[model samples]
Target: MWGTTFNRSRSEQTTVPCHECGAQLKIQRSCHEVFMRCESCDRIYDIADYVAEMDDAMERFMEGVYCDRV
Candidate 1:
């Protein structure tokens, strides 16, 4: 029987700025990941915050809540 496992080791790596030190970090995961640890600053960044904010804004828009644009 052939079985496959969910392996993150083969995920693509990306370089992103560290929220703490502003250094580049190699993120070994997908773009939809909620959080990642910065290799340079050793700090955890909440990437999902932006996604959550967008979701909230979408919900508000669906409810007919509009914000004034400058």
Candidate 2:
């Protein structure tokens, strides 16, 4: 995460489109792992399953990964 200084607006967030409810899925990272979570339906998903659907948010999220290495 980018700590408390950075925050993304709804339009800037990643949207994977949940299979069950058709809601947008959010990309989340925890303890060195990244995954997809659907807030609307309360479901967790493997990020690998939707790599191809990644968009701008994915790029920004991954950027944070290497930034945290410092």
Candidate 3:
């Protein structure tokens, strides 16, 4: 009932706010790229831009990324 894990990516509903719309952003991925998306305004952002906002959710998601790598 929470975040769904896929083969190529992972995501979590995050407390991080979007830079443009000020809405909560979701940490998402496509293939190997990890980024954040704002559902309210349809905006995409590079994950590095929100490094200061990292928390448990982000930490867990990133760990999965590393596990999938060779």
Q: Considering every candidate listed, which one attains the maximal TM-score?
A: 3
| Per-prediction TM-score | 0.38, 0.68, 0.74
| Deviation (Å) of 8 in candidate 1 | 3.7
Tens-digit lDDT track for model 1 on 1-70?
2223322241223344555687754423333333445666677655443233333322322232112210
Clash number for each model: 0, 0, 0
- Which is the winner by lDDT between candidate 1 and candidate 3? 3
Q: By lDDT, is 2 or 3 better?
A: 3
- The model with the greatest lDDT is 3
The regions of model 1 sitting more than 4 angstroms off are 1-7, 10-12, 28-34, 49-70
Clashing residue pairs, candidate 3?
Answer: none
Question: Global lDDT of each model?
Answer: 0.39, 0.68, 0.76
Worst 10 residues of 3 by lDDT: 1-10
What is candidate 3's lDDT per residue for 1-70, written digit by digit as tens? Answer: 2335623346788888899989998888766578888999998888889978987777666766744331
lDDT of 2 at 65: 54
Model 2, 1-70: lDDT tens digits are: 4655443332234766987788988877765566778889998888777778888887677655534421
Candidate 2: residue pairs that collide: none
Better of 1 and 2 by lDDT: 2
